[model samples]
Target: MGERILIAFNRTRERTVAAKTRVADTPASRAVGLLGRDGLGPEEGLWIVPCAMIHTVGMRFPIDVLFLDREGRVRRVISDLKPWRLSPWVWAAHSVLELAGGTLRGSVQAGDRIEFDG
Candidate 1:
């Protein structure tokens, strides 16, 4: 699931949601920290980008959303996204990755290559 699953888009590339896709960028995509929205935890996360907004209702915790670029490089990561709040401008980003809060563990930073389950 890491080959085609880890597909890349041009942003200029037009795509439909039925594609079961994942994005990699910041400033373009937005994510909601649905930690516990549906019994979420530090290992499980729900990411949404090109989505216009992230959903946060009845959530129980916070999560981090990592934005990436075409080369799978980290652009920036927003951590502890509180429930019921919207993220900043993420349109300039190419894709966004969501992980459980505190999942970064010092490994995440700008210019680092990201790996997706794709």
Candidate 2:
């Protein structure tokens, strides 16, 4: 398991703990997103509660990235991410999460809150 990190963005209700300490995924707590070389969609979204890293050590397909706040709200959502792409520098990000291709499959949206265990 990756190191957990706690974070709360903007007008969130509380703080969240990330399972993975992906520092490069987040630059701050406002601008949270992913680095997409391909195209990401709702099918490849992740449901990370507090924080986590979607590490692609040896995987295929693109993934959509989502940035969640404390209120379980989505701060930012980027889609169609291929491979070998670096996430942009976000200034206001509470936490970061990653998922496999077509994994989300129309499950999450804006103003949605999720739970995670650290």
Task: Name the top lDDT candidate.
Answer: 1
lDDT of each: 0.49, 0.46
TM-score of 2: 0.45
Error of 1 at 30 (Å): 9.9
Residues 1-118, candidate 2: write the lDDT tens digits.
4434433222333433223323333333213333433433432333443453344323356665666665546656666556655556444446655655554455555555655532
Estimate the TM-score of every prediction. 0.54, 0.45
* Predicted candidate 1 versus true structure: per-residue lDDT over 1-118, tens digit per residue: 2313342222322321112233323343333333334544444444344332344455666666666665556677777776666666655556566656676555466656654444
Scored by lDDT, model 1 comes in at: 0.49
| Best model number under TM-score | 1
Clash totals, every prediction: 12, 14
lDDT of 2 at 54: 40
The ten-residue window of minimal lDDT in model 2 covers 8-17
